[model samples]
Target: MRLFLVLAFFGVLSLSAGVLMSGDDQDVDWLIAGGLFGVALAGEGARLWLRRGRAKSHESSGI
Candidate 1:
């Protein structure tokens, strides 16, 4: 979770940087933002899913 949060922070930073760097074109900025945000969301989702699986396994094992 902490790692995901850091990655998400970096993703937002990249998006903001892309926008700030974009002067004559916005398409590139949008693309950068989309990719970064997409990866961040996917990573966070996977992290949550893994955590959930771990919890279920622990419950089944009586641990």
Candidate 2:
């Protein structure tokens, strides 16, 4: 999970950089990069949230 989060964060950063470097929206490369970044970010967020919920439950159970 931690590895995934790191990868996703880096993916987003790289994609954002690509988007900024591109001259315009007509650039297919930049568009694809942006889409990949969005997916990575969403996946990371969902995983983190699920982990947090599980941790909370475990703590409440005195495990």
Candidate 3:
């Protein structure tokens, strides 16, 4: 998951710069960048939620 998040982050970053600097959007990167960004964001959110739930359960269980 960490590797995936890093990969997605770089992909989006590089692709975003490429698309913006280019004079046209006639490339596959434009489409792929959005997907990578979305996946990364979703992964981050899931990880955050899971961590919070774990902490709450741990606190309740007196562990």
Which candidate's TM-score is highest? 1
Show where candidate 2 strays beyond 4 Å: 1-5, 8-28, 61-63
Q: What TM-score would candidate 3 get against the native?
A: 0.53
Per-candidate TM-score against the hidden true structure: 0.62, 0.52, 0.53
How many pairs of residues collide in each model?
Answer: 0, 0, 0
Candidates by TM-score, descending order: 1, 3, 2
How much lDDT does each candidate structure score?
A: 0.77, 0.73, 0.70
Query: How would you encode candidate 1's per-residue C-alpha lDDT over 1-63 as one tens digit per residue?
Result: 687677869787878977876777754577767777777778777988999999988785556
RMSD of 2: 5.7
lDDT tens readout by residue for model 3, 1-63: 775768666776857765765556555455556666667677777888999998988775556
Error of 3 at 51 (Å): 0.3
Shift of residue 34 alpha carbon in model 3, Å:
0.6
Error of 1 at 55 (Å): 0.2
Best of the two (2, 3) by lDDT: 2
Question: In candidate 3, residue 53 scores what lDDT?
Answer: 95
How accurate locally is residue 41 in candidate 3, as Cα lDDT from 0 to 100?
Answer: 73
